[model samples]
Target: MCYLYNVESQNTKGPGHSRSLEVPPVRVLLFILATFLGFVLLELWLYWQSKDKPLQLGLWDLIFWGLLIFWSVRVEVRLPLNAGMSQLFLFALALVVLTPPWVAPLAAFLAQWGGSAWYKEFFNRSQDGLATAIAALVWILAQENPLYLGRWDLSDGVGIAAAAFSFFAVNSSLVAFVIHLDSQTPLREIWRRNMGWVALSYILLSPLALLLARAYETPLLGGWGGWTVLFFLIPLYYSRFYWDEKVRLEEAFDTTLELLMNALEAKDPMTRLHSERVADIARDLARKVKDGDEAYAQAIYRAARLHDIGKIAIPEAVLLKPGTLTPEEFALIQSHTTKGAELLSPARKVAFDQLVYNVILHHHERWDGRGYPKRLAGHEIPEEARIVGLADAYEAMTAGRPYRKAKTPEEALREVQELSGHQFDPRLVEAFTELWEQNPIWRDRHAYLAAKEGSVSRSTSPQRSSASASPSPSEPGPRTSEE
Candidate 1:
């Protein structure tokens, strides 16, 4: 799908292009300013057109519906990365269907009266007003006077669906576009993680807006249409609670994984940021291998972060030893793969998918069946496991321990290339070689750390050296290159 952002590629040859999607702070601010001005112009034009036309809704009618929509916005549920969702769209769509074409944008603009940042509040107003205005136009083309309809037919249902899709398309694209510009995240990934699940609520819930409008147009139980709108709140409030529960569950799972990662970090100080680096590389590689499957790439990233979680159960003596391990000590190190899997088995039923268990258990397995607990060879090993294994090996080599000095990025890349088809998947090895040539921030440990800590200078060239080094025969660690 096409995204609403700019992507510039580096003038270099590689398996993937180096995309520069990051926008400057000043540019983002200017974009927000432009959006606000555009909204003002559109609202003014819409008002001017409607000034001479007779309006159907009275002042009290607009006030009543606007108040309901404002209250809906007040209870918006907060999401990650300073985003939020609410059922305000339900009332907004209903307003579009029930009122004149010009009324929807005005109600939407006035609903953004209170928020944290003045600029952000105004931007939200602009985007919402624009989306509603577009939806109102769609409704006008389909049904000239929806307020006067007696009974609905299939064509009327189609009209409502089309209008709902138009609103969501414009609204979601604008919000996702700003986030894409600011954070350099892929638009597909952002939508998958944040907006994909809520899409059904936006589209499938369109019919409810029709019900809301009908209830308002034809009062029941001898009550006013305003009273019927108030009663419609019961089901909408429950639906809002369902969304809240989903977000809460996701947050709880994230917190649990973080706690486990912290415990593992405490036991092995050498692996302080090792998992994070591996995860970053693994995610990029997975995206390339899977042909830009954002959801699968995200799963690979999460599983990579916890691939070595089993090491936490190992004794500190074995974990922190600075010398070569004895035969028995090495056996204990090998057991960490199974130990990690068993430790997280309970979570498998909760939030952990089968992919996570596979990574924890089989990342140590080799393509030639020469490594690890199961000795699974070739395609027998899960693809996720192979991807994480290669990433783990690369990170372990580059990140030095107390006994072994760290390999330079050039040395590590050479070693990885040399081991292809033996300890690593040859296909993945080629992918990684191409990725390294692109000079991503995660190519160097220091670069990755600098980027993580918010430093802008992260340029590094791939060092081309003829020196070839073999993988260490007995580096002896829980998650070393040799394994």
Candidate 2:
């Protein structure tokens, strides 16, 4: 199986769908038990069938391929989010192709014995072993006997391809499902975002396993295919470099965006962790509103975080004004929406998605069509913008400016409810109400900060931790801070 493991990071770009990747301990344990038990049952059944009719099994071949797979398992390449990929599947699948149904999965189970924590290692071994068992069954169904140079024809190639595809499908689904359970991300979305490209690679590279099996069968290379198998190392080593560069580039992009966010916060201290709080709320609401579209949920999350990017360009004088703003000053403040959109436009093709641009430009727009910039109202405003707008208002109301007293959580909830149809999508307001009832840490600023502090001190899952932490949101600052 092509194993994927989560690597925790602050950036939300990769596969770790949410800030907290916690799953119900019971569910995870049940899944591991089920998977491991299923593999054992299959192995026992396969062994029973083999006993009835003796089949050629190569112990030396098993040792050689198991060691190769172990080596591959040790060198995993990181992917975005908490996921990773490695060449473990290549040799493991090759072992499935060349050996009997019972042998390869056992070898795979043993090969994955001690890499990660005990629970993680057990889960990996179980899933990989189960996937190998299923793929080995597919190979047996396609071609009754193991492949040799004599049997290596076009039809056998089709069987190998089918087996390879089955392996990928089973393996990725198992991993994706676990991630889905852990992060509450949609299962289909997980596969679409993470496993789509890897599927193609599985099919394209399956031929190499066939060649390996054939090489072992051939007398031209002396003993087994061990000598030629060594050649796979060069290409595998180089492939790691490719994935490394890709991950580096992604990290660089994330870092650059963070720097921009940092600069925005420095210019407007009021919005320090304000964006992160709003983003957390927006993402939660987005999942409720657009549960089927993972991309939209993720986009709204990103857009909420940068919704105030335009505020960076606003003059500090007007931004810091304590008294009611003059018409001209208010206008200047509103133009931050357009300015932010323009500033981010250059990166649209490269980094920012259209939904992100929409939220940055239109987050302040009111549902009643009275808001600024485009003044797009109702459904005319992008749904992404509407979601962010509602979240931003809630966050800003609770995280009051230095000149204004911050509203209590109950007061903020009432205000949000009162403004429902007039300032927010009624459906979204309903969704937010439900989320509020759930009492997510972000629903209350004080609780959010407490949880953050606790998470830092106790190393717990700080689901509500924003992009950055600072003094309390309600505390006064150097200037009159406005949302």
Q: For residue 310, what is the lDDT in candidate 2?
A: 89
- Candidate 1, 41-74: lDDT as tens digits: 7667767766776677788988888998788777
lDDT of each: 0.75, 0.72
TM-score of 1: 0.86
How many clashes (backbone atoms < 3 Å, residues ≥3 apart in a chain or on different chains) does model 2 have?
4
> How displaced is residue 307 in candidate 1, in Å?
0.7
CA RMSD per model (angstroms): 8.1, 8.5
lDDT of 2 by residue, 22-75 (tens): 334577668778888999998888777665644455677667788887877777
Q: Model 1, poorest ten-residue lDDT window?
A: 1-10
Top candidate (TM-score):
1
lDDT measured at residue 212 in model 1 versus the true structure, 0 to 100: 88
